[model samples]
Target: MVAIDANEVSKRYGTLQAVDRVDLTVEEGETFGFLGPNGAGKSTFINMLLDFVKPSHGSVSLFGNDCQGEGVAARSRIGVLPEGYSTFDRLTGRQHVEYAIRSKAADDDPIDVLDRVGIREAADRKASGYSKGMAQRLVLGMALVGEPDLLLLDEPTTGLDPNGAAEIREILREENERGATVFFSSHILEQVEAVCDRVAILQDGELVALDTIEGLRETMGGGTKLVITLDRLEDGTLETIWAVEGVDTAVATEESTVEITCTNDAKMDVIVALHEAGLDVLNFRTEEASLEDMFVEYTGAGR
Candidate 1:
């Protein structure tokens, strides 16, 4: 089931086309990552989903209801942690959280929410005195006020330290385990890889790839970095590697090591081909391709 569906959404600013005709669907109870470079229209797409920016052309639905229909009843069912969010500096952390709970008509206690986000000890402190990471945590805690069914986070961990980031990730996991659908947008590919079940990558306001990590790798001409310890470099080795199907590039040095880049399901073939090339393979390690590599390959190559 799709928790959020965007059909052929397009947004334009003057002569600049921010979001092209893009289609996206986020499954219920899934942690979906929205990834893109700057100016790739991620923010525009998110704003449209929240009804903050009306799409130039297209439709948005949340839990099978039109996003723009009625008085944002659909929005009340979801939590949002926007990028560069700021709160009233004079309000104490506890007051901010209490206000958010009351505004959302939530039944949960604000103390529990503060503790869950690890900000309880400092709840009575003024927001003006909180550090960047602490302020971000308060914002996230505000979003958790009602335990909404869906969470829309934009760069949720932007100003956090490693420990804080880990804490936030753990909280997200716990929420997902409790059956909440999480739509998290971020440029940090490593964080996305760690937390998201599926990812959609956008480039220059265009959707380039959408799939599981493994699936994306397969579609981008799968790359494998081979660290081989050879007894000695042998002749015909380079020629033999190029002969392997899907082996797009190979560099072998006189130092008895070869690094290879290839496509889908080509590692085993590469190993066999290398052995066939008559080099005594002492140890071989293949580095799996990451989302960054796929991004570079597709966007950099102008695909």
Candidate 2:
């Protein structure tokens, strides 16, 4: 079953087109990541998915139910940790979790939820006194109430420290293992790369790329960077290496070393070509493009 579906989804706010026409589908039990720079319509698209904001054009569905027409039923089956969710100042963390449990009609123990998020020690503390990280954890625990079939987390690690972030990643993994589909949205490419089964990159309010991590690297022309150390460079060495099919770029970075960027399938060809050219293959190391590298290439944001 398709867990979430959006067809030509778009939203405009007066002069601003917050989300351009976009189509997306997430399969059941998949951990999907939504990525984009600020103002790229990620939050807007999420809002449309929750029916928090109406799209100017297009349609969305959750678990085969129309989001707009079946808003309550759709939401009832999902847990959401929205961007900048507000908490009642007077409510304790435990109270917050309990409230979510009650709202969902879920038979959940608030204490267990707090323990799962590693905030049990602060369970009795009023949200007004909670630190940003503690508050973030509290909300996350609330989202875990009843183990909903789907999770929509937007910037879930926003205020977490490194340890807290790691804990969240672990929780996401555990949740996925338990057969829940997770929709994660965040700017932290590393976190998304750590947990997502597949990712979609948004640019200028449109879907620019969508694939598995390695697939995205391939789509963006990101390949293995092979740096070879040589005893000495012979004349025409660079030309000879570049002539190898699938070798995108080859340049001498130093008198004794050359860097070649090429498809993974071409690494051996590059080595063979260099050897055939009478250059000793002293030593070679490869560096794979990280998700961040592909993210920058696709969104043009890191530049």
State the lDDT of candidate 1 residue by residue for 4-29, as single tens digits: 99899899999999998899899999
Task: Please report the TM-score between candidate 2 and the true structure.
Answer: 0.82
**Residue-wise C-alpha lDDT for candidate 2, range 275-297, written one tens digit per residue:** 88888988999988677767665
Query: What are the lDDT scores of the predictions, listed in order?
Result: 0.83, 0.88
State every prediction's TM-score relative to the real structure: 0.82, 0.82
After superposition, the stretches of candidate 2 with alpha carbons farther than 4 Å from their true spots are 226-285
Candidate RMSDs in order: 4.7, 5.1
CA displacement after TM-score superposition, residue 188 of candidate 1 (Å): 1.5
